[model samples]
Target: MTMVNLSFVLFLLCGVLINVQIARSDECITGSIRKLYEELNCIPEHDETNGCITSYNCSFTNDQRADKCYYQGREFSDGDRLEHNDFRSKCIPTCSCLVRDGRAEFNCAHYDCAEFFQPPLKKNCMRTYSHDSCCAVGVYCKKENEEETAATCEYGGKVYTEGATFFPNEEPCKKCICKPGFSGSLESPWCEEVFCEIEIHHAESIRDNCAPVYFGDNSCCPINFHCAHASSDETQETEVESTTITQKANDNTPTCKFGNSTVEIGRKVRGPEECTECSCKVPPLIECVVNSECQEGKLKTAN
Candidate 1:
């Protein structure tokens, strides 16, 4: 073969090889690229300027597929649910993960106060004005009633007229009655010592026979109070039970139930009498060391 003819054949071979390479890499590469974007289309097309031809991948990556959400160091996907106490909310307790715009988001439903005021969780139901976002924010049953009046308790976005009662799940250890307020008005729920009694039958006899316990998550009533059986291991079990109760009292939540409400360790509560102050040095135990309460006349004078 002649030298020129061989050179022409070599050039043709080079052109074919170049075309094959271009065809193989015509599509865009994944991850960050430095090519200038012009005709950014999903379909592959040839570009004379730069090889940055294919449209950028507009899909989710492998690590984050199936739509998930991370919140407070927790991962939640579609249909996953969170308890009411799982995360603090000023309104509702339970939160659900829902798909919104193809992403997971936390959604909380409106709580109903009247619905929870049943036999098991609570009885003698009275609406909670504190520690309950549903009652504080929405108030009653989360619906506008045409018959709602000014003398009604707002809860769960609805209205509870006078004499209507609800058992707030936030602080289920308190007892409430559907009766009128202490001063003969519904302005404020009676909030004095022994003001309300949770329907728990924890009498002196029951206390000796069985240990006081809580069955439900926040239910104050314990019909059985059955944490252990009666046997010769009573003393050892009692000591162990006392330790457990002490541990529970110090377990990052409320430890002791007072006349009106529950208190935590190191917390200040009411003292021996009115206008007196005390501290919860131990779980369910109060120590009155600080006595700086001004007399009623002094308070009136200051006012």
Candidate 2:
């Protein structure tokens, strides 16, 4: 080949090699940022913002002189206007990068080491109840950092983005059944609780008519009534007795049967037979009925 041709071919090869190297360098920087965040358990706080590093900011080796080595778009030029002139070299020693006097220092000793790290999503993996992954309400979610964090669940009526703080264990996961007179809506609806209990009130002679009012269990007491001394025949006994009423036309004595013996009710009869013969002994009556006619005067009392 001619010298000129050879030179042109070498130039083309050099261009291709430079492009590949740059690409590799960028990827390395990006990968390092990710690794550093992982080690520190750093989660991104914003949902829309991409991670701290991009391909343009990453590289295979920790170069102290590269402008945009740590963050995408943000570069540490040795002679940038104002501030620390040695911004690039300091970040080399540690992954912990510090900004001082307009200069950035990299220090990996401990960078956001307290954050909760989110595991990468697995291929075709389904999400299950993750009680351990939940955090408290009101968190600045990120992919890996706590303050700058993000989530991968649904919240605030919207689906959470990746790397957000997940409130898997929060009270919102399970809902409490609302008592009566309450309504549930879409944005904020009540959910059924694991176990719910209900209360009932009852008064003597008036059993509680308690039944399940809503999504809970109910109880009844003194609220219920046994058929008044229900007979083997399943009849409720009466509460009143027989009385004697003097008829305007005739003062004939009225009688009632009391335990196989006839006695006079209200007339104060001396003998059971006499009372029964006199039609004064009132018999036990069924409930909801007034047997005061057998008695002298009408006295009202409920069973």
Candidate 3:
């Protein structure tokens, strides 16, 4: 009830009110800065030294382009969106798909070949080496032996080897032919040895019917003549009926069959004249003067 007691109580009350006001002001400033950051896509920087004891904020301006980004009342030095072309865009012909629309734009520091080199949404018209970095065209692989001891011969993996396998099986069936003393050569006709062989069939048929190699990521690979790459994915479709690589011989010689056609291993046949039955004629002598080559021993002795 005394004056001094009342004055003391009043001072304490004033101090408490001031402290409450300062706390409310700090909270309001922090909430406001956070809201601003969200709206402007700016980073928030906390600095309590400059009257910002509770919380602080910062934003990027025209003066600083690369040093800062603001978010949630905090400033970050580095922040970015998804890298553009750095990711390879893989596209397919038969199915509907979704991908980023615009070209992925980014500095080399942020985007590189590993992440964006194989995006699934890139231009499909561009010639691609491989769909998912697996196979290449004209990949020659040597046929595996029956013993399964042979390594797979890849087409362009440093060493080049043409793959061949027998059509029916890995090796020819052994016939029950008993030989006396076995004096003949191991590969002779009487020896009944296993030989690598291939059936004479259309070779040109595959030239046009061969389908493009589909990559694992659903991109079409460029075709190369001898051994083009192919998709091993189960979802991918193959144009031919089980285009399997069977075992066959390595001979390129064309065989003449009694049927309507004859085929050589590598040569292309236009018609029946190239068959075995076709007669080969020796052209007339252009500079021959031998007496025996004439009608008689000495051209009838000059008649």
lDDT of each: 0.38, 0.27, 0.25
- Which parts of model 2 have CA positions greater than 4 angstroms off? 31-303
Q: Candidate 2: minimum summed lDDT over ten consecutive residues — where?
A: 195-204
Error of 1 at 209 (Å): 6.1
TM-scores vs. true structure, each candidate: 0.24, 0.14, 0.13
Q: Assess candidate 2 and give its lDDT.
A: 0.27
* Alpha-carbon runs more than 4 Å astray in model 3: 30-303
Q: Report the alpha-carbon TM-score of model 2 versus the true structure.
A: 0.14
Where is the poorest 10-residue window by lDDT in model 3? Answer: 279-288
Point to the candidate with the largest TM-score. Answer: 1
Best by lDDT: 1
State the lDDT of candidate 1 residue by residue for 16-59, as single tens digits. 97886676454333211111111111133333344433222312
